[model samples]
Target: MALGFEELDFQQTPMGELFLRRRVEPTLGADVYEVKLGDEYLMSSLFTEAEEQLAHLGLAPLDGSDLAVLVGGLGLGYTAVAALSHDAVGAMTVVDALPAVIDWHERGLLPVSAQLTGDPRTRLVLDDFFALMRRDPEARYDAILLDVDHSPRHSLDPSHADLYTPDGLRRLARHLREGGVFALWSDDPPDDDFMADLGTVFASTRAHVVEFANPLTGGTSTNTVYVAHSAG
Candidate 1:
């Protein structure tokens, strides 16, 4: 497939800002253009399968009580939107480093994101999720969905690499309540070393794949989601 490119203008949302390419190319083979949050190439409609699946992992087993969720990386807000769709979810807190990305949702740059932003259960936080995890929590969340950068390996920002490291993972893990689940979305499968480290941190660990086709590259892509439980 021949790759095509076009410049996209950006708009602000309450959570972060979104940049969209005005002229979408069929040759590029997708309806949605690149979505960037500040300097981060967050995501596009292309990989929505992975985003939606990440949300499903959190919402699928809800027991119908007050379930609060923290979503890292608002991206196009698919994960946040999907989380709010579940009746079992009482509160959904979305955190992103870029305020412009959030603003895009607030200003209706992305209609789907706007719907989620408008939801009463949604709270958009304009801070790094890692910072929030380290701070005293106003309340403990039932689930934490992390999809920052591409994966534990590739980061939109080099500093974000700490988020996947053992120390960082440990800090993020501490935020969860007993029996709470921490699910992370990776652009690629984690290596043996990474998996081994996760095993030591969580009582039980499991990983699932979300497959997608990248029309631009004409190659099949698979994203992984790692679900770690504090209490098994």
Candidate 2:
């Protein structure tokens, strides 16, 4: 029998203290894994619909097989795993700033670790996602799915703020193949302002409201997935 709660791992990083913990949920009678950075709860296995949708919505517009995908923020590996579910996805590169988070997945501490690490198509890279996008990359991807920041208006770090801007988005678009898709997961509701900014960089953009059951609240919670298509 599993205990009520257990702290799986902890690490001190430049951002803050990171923690991975597992607890037996009384309501679901199952083990729930969660990650926290400092006092902020990063992600939980309990609610992953939005995370999964980030990949689905992002790739829905893309066509053809052997797709190359890039995923930012490998939290719990849900987004990366979900992206791999598509047959068209030939290769997937997941980038994260914190190496400790990558270690947790490599160590199989998280539930979806096996699905992410076992697949030959998946490449887990320990790097700042934003920094990579800012640099002149040698390769471009068919799709880019990002789930790092809380929202365009709310960023985990100030350095991430620029990525939301029109110029920053344009730079990100440069890394995408023609007609490539860019999808983002945001905790905040749809923002008209951000949509306008995305309009400047991509050919088309839409915000999808993904609602999932909230076990703790006994109701539904919603997250936003913003999908944009590059003009080429």
Off by over 4 Å in 1: 1-18, 27-30, 37-40, 217-219
Q: Worst 10-residue stretch by lDDT in candidate 2?
A: 1-10
What C-alpha lDDT values do all the predictions have?
A: 0.75, 0.94
Error of 2 at 118 (Å): 0.5
Give the TM-score comparing model 1 with the true structure, all chains together.
Answer: 0.84
In candidate 2 the C-alpha lDDT for residue 48 amounts to: 96
Q: Write the per-residue lDDT of candidate 2 for residues 1-232, one digit (tens) a residue.
A: 3689999998999999999999998999999999999889989999999999999999999989999999999989999999999999999999999999899989999888998999999999999999888999778999999999899998989999999999999889988999999999999999999999999999999999999999999999999999999885
